[model samples]
Target chain A: MSNTSAPNKDLPGTILAFIFIGVGCLAWWDTFDMGDSDSYVFPRAVIVTLIVCCLLLIGRNIIWGGGKNHKPLDGSAWRRIGLVLAMLGTALLMPVFGFIIVGMVLFGVLIIIAMFEPWTRKLAIAYPLIGATIVISFYLLFAVLLNVTLPTGSLFD
Target chain B: MENPISYFFMSWSDPYLLLMTAAGTFAGVYVGAIPGLSVTMAVSILISFTFSWDTNEALALMVGVYMGGVYGGSRTAILLNIPCAPSAIATAIDGYPLAKRGEAGTAIGVATVMSFIGGLVGILVLAVAAPLVSEFALMFAPRDYLLLAVIGILLVGSLSGESLAKGVFAGALGVIIGMVGLDPLTAEGRFTFDSITMMGGIHYVTAMIGFFGVAEALAQLHHLETPAIKQKLERITPKWSVVKRYIPLSIRTSFIGVFIGALPGTGGDIAALMAYDHAKRSVKDPSRKFGEGAMEGLVAPESANNAAVGGAYIPMLTLGIPGDAVTAVFIGALYIHGLNPGPMLMIETPHLFWFTVGALMLANVFMLIFGLTGVRLFIKLVECPRAILVPLILILSVVGTYAIQNNVVDVYWMLGFGIFGYFLKIYGYQVGPVILGVILGPLMDVSYRRAIISTRESFGDFMLEMVTNPISALLSAALVFLVVSQTPMYKRWTNKRRSV
Candidate 1:
């Protein structure tokens, strides 16, 4: 996390992968019924390969030891990261907040932050409202009109 | 081949089929011209709608979309700097420059004619060479396929933006990512630790949307204030004399496109780039304005990319192996319609082959009609503010990814990869190799495993076979030559010789 050290960017990605791999190994070991031609055989092999790859990646990172110089994470990098987090947050809340509301809110926030358009009287207030309307129309078209079921929030029920 | 006149008359006799071709062509052009919407996406969406329709009708629609989509990408490449699909990346290099010179109409006209010509050539090859080529393809064992996949990975090194090492690293990373989900040979979950969702593996389409579409949008966000494109439609028509000048180049590039396209795993994007590179090297005096706004530049990639479409189908129709993702989806449609694409297909269903050829010809004619009229409307789209367009594109990407299986999890996966893709881009890693890896990784895995198993787990035998086989040895030699020629030592030595 130290900015001066030039964080190994691949470290974060690698660690996240390790977690997934570990969880997968545990799951495969615990519940996988290895009954001759059980479906778990495929999953188990995949997990083992993943674990091997993950360990190799971790070892490679250690041996290389930040050999290639990377630019320190600047404020802009942080902002981009924040935007990613925000998008993920919205996705997480989508089923809870309904597709229309979450989509509109996310769209408005992203446009404002990413586009850097001035929040003039007609722009900020109007854009988010319009985004909401358009998204609702799309929902109706796909879900109601076209008979495709979109995630309706618990509140709607 | 099979009484061309009789085939022509048979196609002409079917009025409904003709109408369907016209509709598909029109729809393909429109969908393809739209930025962020690719031919693959358009065809895939059409597949769902055509699920209930008869095979012939479905084929007409899919083929129309396929032809249109391939040609359609050129429109955006010319009018806007953005390519509608990966194949159009080469098209944009020359096409955009011509558009910038205020000859948008002329460029579109030339592209239309060339696309039609290219489509016709591809169809001709598909009709004549498919049977012969398919036999050759079947002779390729798993080891040959594994070598082919490695060659594809090497393309990542060539395509990686600045640093060869970085590109190789990205490619390796992609291969690793691709290894996630289930293993083909052992059916083992290679990377998916335990989550049921992870066990299914990441869908290549979702990764593609994330890496290309979402990553592109995020990158565009960094330069939102760039000047809006000003398109002028004056003097749009190509002079007959000018068109005649490029006929030789167009025809040659078309041959290149079809041949490359016919090769499994290669598609129009690579064909167009290779054609452009070859044209650049081969032409002695390629007009002073080649890259800046050369007509030959526009003609070469356009002709080749469209021709590659036909080339791609050669493998699909004859061997049940897709030349590209679009054709892969087409293979699914073929399966749905109770037709299996293999050697037996030619023997059992000759009519289907003829119908497909007829469809390709009709699609080309329709491309000309749609291309000319649609250019004006498409130019207008470039003027739309990015603020409005970007959000819409995101919605489309989300919906399109989800529509693949109507699964929300896919959408989340797309968004996750999109974020990861953006970081990769900022670090100067090219997305092309990552995509190529994702596309070719499974083939590499399956083929390598099969080769190993077939050789009785003898690693030495498998290695020997790769080196001993004529085609594999040749491919390996080419790959070695490519890598060696690109090295720093070679460049330095060449420079020293030149100084002498």
Candidate 2:
């Protein structure tokens, strides 16, 4: 390792500050179109405060160093990527494959990526059974008891 | 007035409500013990299912979950070294080490009994203080309320994050999001962006689910492979000697819990941490060295966090401000049930006040019953792999968000927020402030506008009124103090004083 003392946190911090600055500028400009003063007053006040806070963040990062020193995360990066994709994919596919179908697919993808154990005959039988039970129980609770209409997919329609 | 005694025993007398309370507490134990599951998330989701319930039934169940969940977190903190909630983070310091020494059962039992004691203290405080506070709150002007909302957001922001700026940033972002849709005063669009869909604005429940439920699940994805630790069990109950020995310490910390918990926007997690700090400084001797399995470690945090549940209700019931995130969700549930929670809540629905106290007392009792028993079953459930739990949480978040308004658009908004929230968390920003901002943002806007209108929109008069009014002046000073304390000059001054 070159040196643990210095990590390039300023790059991310500065970039985040600029991002908020951009949001602040855009919001300020958007306020021009509001016909009434009262409609934009609170938002304009909030926008200004936000911009100042971002500037302060930049100053603090320069003087005192990065705030909370949390490492991005450990373990497999592939798992995080898969987990995000599985969830986002579930949302995208929910309207197409239906809630149950997409949910099970998400569960299948998650199980494969999340598993750290050596695949065994017992786990093969157990994992599927357990996942099915969890999904079905939630379905009954939400659909039957709570009366939420789970999407049956556009294909069925 | 009409004999509050009958209402006091409402949950205990009614069979269905009694069952709901018991069942809620039982479920709450598992929810709190399970890593990644939170009382906030559970209460938010449960609102969807309980929407059609009688107001009493819903209140009973939510209180049961709230009381039980606060105590349940100590379980995994003792066994697995993984605190399921922020409130139990302190518990794990002493709890897991004790478990390593084959004293897991004792630590858990002590935590349970202390938690029960702390909970009773919180309830007693709430019963006495809320009525008085509500009466006091009736005198608040719009300017005072505006200042209050500002202070509440700043307080939450100041304490939650590593840096005050980042905390303020998140809160401001939430306020912006909340400012979307119809301007209630002018009945004109604020941040609608010309989309008809934006007219209704984003629901705070959607924000709650996205930030807490889905984001937490995604965050836990990074630790899915972490193995579970086995716990050793012995005498499931502690001796009277041990319990009696910790009573003074428990009571002292329980008071700390109530005081911190009653503060708007702070809650049990902060209370537990402060109590643990006090125990470390106050106790000269221990059953073992602190963080090396000291009994005092478990007792202090467990007592304080439970007491905080009662403390948290004070502001929510009296002033319509959330003392913490769980109470924030409770406020949302109250609104959905057509009940407005504020200073007038006590006067308008006195029965509701007595019933809530009764229900909380019932929940506290149920928490003890469920906390002491079912160790084996709980351990097995806790052993469930993270691979399954994370996915289930996501699904639940989806169903819950969609159920709120039966809108697919809300689900999309929820998922968008979840993804955005994940990045915010990784970068070390606290989402608690953001949620607090959303909860208080609308109230802040209305109060500010009303105050401004009172002054005929004269900015100077508004500023002058802030200083002239006693309540407003006091609140403004507190806000100034909170902000000033975060400045480098103040930090340097404090350091210099301590060095002398």
Candidate 3:
């Protein structure tokens, strides 16, 4: 919420570096009680080195304003986000609805949304049907032929 | 050792083996041409599919995919600026420019020939060097591996665009993400936060799908309205004269590719970039045209990446250290096929080595045939409407990720990281370094830990030991020089010196 755009660019990198440093410090602390001959010796060194490197990178970023001007958010950003969500939703639903059903519906939706081309009747039927067949074949190849277990939705049962 | 001639004859005679090789090559090409789908994924999936099969059959299938996948990436690189795999990134630099200039066919032709030459060189090296290298590689200690992983990470500077800090940061982030799973040395969960699934850590393949495939798809959506590729279909044959002209450069780049590929943890991607950089630096007369669709640019990267495929096998067969992720998975396939790869492998299973060399040689020949005929079809693929093609790619990505472990969790992870990756890419962060981190992180962790434990209680001794070890010392010096050369201070100093 700070209007300090100067600091914002460096914040993400700094936060990441601090997180590493924090973790490294914790690793070092946990092993601090160990004797010099202990196995924790090298891990502690690696952790310490990682902390130093992270701090150096963070320091450099802060000094440089993270290099180059940050571009404004593009308009398609939300649409892209939505497409990702839709893909995730479909993947989650695959086991429940069957890979075939989920794949077909998602393929239809994605093609329509992503391409934004007006659907012809031929494509509307063909695309999903083709997509479904591909998924089903893969399901058979892995689950049946290859003898690997795939998610079989309750709908099939 | 079984006679190399007999093994070659057996491999050539087997009908099923021949069929699998052809099928694998075809599948690898198709998979590699699609943006986001890589040869590594295809080969890994093939491993799972061939898990129940015979050893020779499994090796044959995997080798076919390996050879095909490496060549397949050139298709997308030439047609679109989007590299089908990281190895093809350098290929895209000159290839896309060639396509834009209506020389797509000629570029593909040259790439195909160079790929064949590169593959042949790699196979020859594998056949001859495996025994010698395996003997030498046995001398590697955990400390040596640690230094090698450090060198691998240093490559992040060379691969990352413009900003060294961002590249290192991305790479460090990848290493941290890689650390999210179980700690190899301590057998303790480092970053899993006590969750059952978290204990398993993230799969590199899933990370790859997200980083390369899904993120790439998301990036494509922004440029959706860009005009479809309009390629002028020309004769897809490389003229003998043109081939003769670049033969010297091709062989040079192939050697570059193979040597880099033979080094533990390095792969075609690095080889191709290094080769391209070499070509740029070395070619004085045509250096001005390097990026503007230069033939040398296309030749250097393509030959190197293909040659790298062969180079990658060296470490895999000799030291049991995979040169790249795909070869790492290929090592898994080798194990599944009842072949253990290591120093003793050459002695214990010499026949297997000969068979692999033969298969690779045959696969390269198949690549030439498939590559030449397949060019027109691949170019047509670039013309497919985004509406259809994008959805299909998404589906393949999901299927590919799911096929790895048959886990929906991976799909979710892929999508999660896909979104995260998209944000990272838009912010001008390079994903390649993150991948390098993920791949090299565990190696770095284990070796560093081992080096310390081996050195007893003295951190100074541990440091001294690395500095004193000849190979480690050399690698350290090189890493130091590379980092210094890339630093902003070095650049400023150089600029001031130039102006004065």
Among these predicted structures, which one has the highest TM-score?
A: 3
Best candidate (score: lDDT)? 2
Write candidate 3's Cα lDDT for A89-108 as tens digits.
88778888777778777777
Worst 10 residues of 3 chain B by lDDT: B152-161
Q: Which lDDT tens digits does candidate 1 get at residues B175-194?
A: 65676776665566655656
Compute each candidate's TM-score over C-alphas.
Answer: 0.77, 0.74, 0.80
Candidate 2 positional error at B430, Å: 2.5
Q: On a 0 to 100 scale, what is the lDDT of residue A68 in model 2?
A: 43
The alpha-carbon deviation from the true structure for residue B230 of candidate 2, after best TM-score superposition, in angstroms, is 4.8
lDDT of 2 by residue, B1-500 (tens): 67787998989999999999998898888778754357887788799889999999998998998898988888877765546676776787688778666677777888999999999998888888875643454557788767766765665565445577887888898888888888888888777777899889988767866776667667766766666445556666778998899999999999888876776655676678668767876887888887689999889989999999988888888778887888999889889999998878877888888898899999999998898898755555335676665666676677667766767778788877888777787777767667657766887899899999999999999999999988889879977987897776888998899799
Predictions ranked by lDDT, top down? 2, 3, 1
lDDT of 1 at A102: 78
Candidate 1 stretches greater than 4 Å from native: A1-82, A115-157, B1-4, B30-55, B72-114, B232-250, B263-305, B315-349, B495-500
Clashes of 1: 15
Residue A58 shift from truth in candidate 1, angstroms: 16
Candidate 3 Cα misplacement greater than 4 A, ranges = A1-66, A70-73, A117-150, B1-24, B27-62, B73-110, B235-246, B260-302, B312-355, B493-500
iRMS, candidate 1, in Å: value is 5.6
Model 3 TM-score, all chains together: 0.80
